[model samples]
Target: MPNRIEYYNFVNGGYFWHHASGETYPLGILVDQGDVLSDRQPHGKPAGTLIIYKDGNVAVKELLSIKSEKNVWFAISGCTILPKINMTAAGFTGVYSDIGRTTLRPVIGYRKKDKKIIIAVRPSSSITRAQITLKNLGCDFGITLDAGGSTALQVKGKKLHNTTRRLNNVITW
Candidate 1:
């Protein structure tokens, strides 16, 4: 869980946060170091995956399109949070219904132009507002890892935000 970030034994200090709100037992796809950790569902339904390659490139792809490539370092699945149909805020809520609700959320994004990854937590924001935030931050694509009580963020062993709800998975450096 994201709250346990401080307990990890990492060589270089980095950030940690909640990754996904999916079921813990396994339903969608999850991969680590080229190993398929879970794939009960085989395909991610209404979900997007954050792929981190061993070479350090990142991409947000649909779950159905993912493969356990040799160079893939890790992959985390979650709901798409930005780039709605036609790139309009009005259509953003159509992708995920829960995102329409205003609440705290943890997000991960990528800026294709500059090859930057954006990770953040937004408080009391709707999907539309969160999309706007991501766009303002220069993100071309993004996904909402978790929301509400599951939202969390930590950096350098210190928590910038903490959640009361226990998390099933988390992303870290």
Candidate 2:
């Protein structure tokens, strides 16, 4: 998590939360000011979502589709929580996987209705439940960042969730 001085540097600060996790470096492709910080190759298929910040706007895109680096002020990746799937009247049953065991999740969500980006921390939940929560929150798409002991969230300088593990990436505003 960022300290007081570091958090103050953000132009439009509102929410501050841990974004990604690693020991010595970030796990995904981290971009700052159009500079590629870490291009760590993914192990299997691109299952991450790229959270991008550009022109004072935030966009969440699939890791595989983001090919261009133009105007990318800052970028980070997180595990895909809500994959592209047809939402029928029943529910998102097809995407309910038991892979992600119950745990705290830091999420980034995108509402297609207004093209708004949301940064929130979900309570101890599975990936399926987290996806459902975001879907209920009107998020069309979302991703889960490093969770468990690395999960952290702060709103308006007040610590909501703080972890002992060191954080590698954080998103402000």
Candidate whose TM-score is highest: 1
Question: Could you tell me the TM-score of candidate 2?
Answer: 0.70
lDDT of each: 0.61, 0.59
- Model 1 C-alpha lDDT per residue in residues 106-167, reported as the tens digit of each score: 77789998888778777888767777888889898876665666666667767677766545
Superposed model 2: Cα runs more than 4 Å off: 1-5, 8-23, 53-60, 64-69, 84-99
lDDT tens readout by residue for model 2, 42-115:
43234455555666666656453345546887666656666542222112234533226688777777887887
lDDT over C-alpha atoms for residue 20 of model 2: 54
lDDT for position 161 in model 1: 71
The residue pairs in collision within model 1 are none
| Candidate 2: residue pairs that collide | none
Error of 1 at 80 (Å): 1.5
